[model samples]
Target: MSCQHAPSSDGNPTEADSLVIKVVETSAAGKQLSELTKFTASGADVVEITIKPNETYQTITGFGGSFTEASAYLLNQLSPDNRQRILEAYFGDAGARYSLTRTHINS
Candidate 1:
């Protein structure tokens, strides 16, 4: 089914409330959340959705990178073993290299 939009129950019900969503898909065949580009759905099977856009209660805002001191502080707050595990996870070959510096740290 193809959905265009739906009426927002929080607001009033109307054609405008119908949520016209941009459809995308991810597949093992290399479709990484790609839009359903040229496909169109019609007939009674066409679906609709509604959402209240302004209802978000909270959000996280930050830059993409560079919170170095913050990282050091949180890490130091952990116990010795916990901190070591965290450090290993960040710097180990099989883990994410979240370490900005090549040098190792001791706490």
Candidate 2:
């Protein structure tokens, strides 16, 4: 489904959200296995796996690579255990990363 772009209270068009995913599979069997596992796992009430693709261009435009780089830098500054946990939670096997695009006006 496509999200709508609307004006906020400040009379500016809101950000645009979209994603295009291309799953990487080594073989046909692997593809089948991945799809099957994902479908079957969804039967449970809780979430099992969540993957979100990043829009490199849009993201770089919104927040420069330095921002993300700095974030990783800060995370690296944490203790080994804490960094591991934070990295796991943020860029774990099952996490979603979203990209937002919009234009802001300066008053």
Candidate 3:
């Protein structure tokens, strides 16, 4: 995912801004997909997707998951080595790469 934001001429962020976002798909075939279409005054049914890597409209903070009491209990029951493996599986770069997480209070 990519986003692009246009800044105001006065060097200040304004409520009225221009933003364009595009989705980048990863595939084993190494295929890149992007399309551009112009809309007519009468309106068109066709839809087009445009990809611009240099353009960014939004910033992603993080990806995360929640931890439940049941899950926590199960995890704590595991051995230290097993616990390390589970943590790495979720937070590791080769895994889901979860950057944010939450645990319910008193759960």
Candidate 4:
């Protein structure tokens, strides 16, 4: 995954500020929350976005993952040591850091 935060230019700040955007990308090829350095646009590569931070649209209570029977089975297939390593890699401070979970699995 990749993230790009548009420059903030709020000389005269207000609820209506510049429409900043951050883009993150992830790929099965192994990318995980990787940020993009630049964007090479085509002749007509254009889009529109509106940012309204003050608006009350939806609220995100939390973020988390699900545990299924199949997942449990696969996890049990691994040795205890290997399983611990995988757990840490996904929920440890040095890793992805999820919610109650720490995670960067796709940060």
Instruction: Report the C-alpha lDDT of model 2 over 12-91, residue by residue, as the tens digit.
Output: 34344222323334465544423222222224574322323432434343321223555656877999999877655544
Best by lDDT: 3
- List, residue by residue over 1-107, the lDDT tens digit for candidate 4: 23234445753344444343456668898987676554543367656445567778888765557556667678889999999987787677887665553334433
> What are the C-alpha RMSDs, in order, of all predicted structures?
13.1, 17.3, 9.8, 7.3
lDDT of 3 at 94: 86
For model 4 the TM-score comes to 0.50
lDDT of all predictions: 0.62, 0.43, 0.75, 0.61
**For model 3, where is the 10-residue window of minimal lDDT?**
34-43
| Candidate 1 lDDT over residue span 1-107, tens digit each | 24555446765676554344466888999988787854434588675543557778777452123436667789889999999897777676666755465323442
Error of 4 at 14 (Å): 13
Off by over 4 Å in 1: 1-67, 102-107
- lDDT of model 3 at residue 41? 24
Q: What local lDDT does model 2 show for residue 65?
A: 20
Q: After superposition, how far is residue 21 of candidate 4 from its true place, in Å?
A: 8.7
lDDT pick, better of 1 and 4: 1
- lDDT winner, 1 or 2: 1
lDDT of 4: 0.61
Clash count, one per candidate: 7, 0, 5, 14
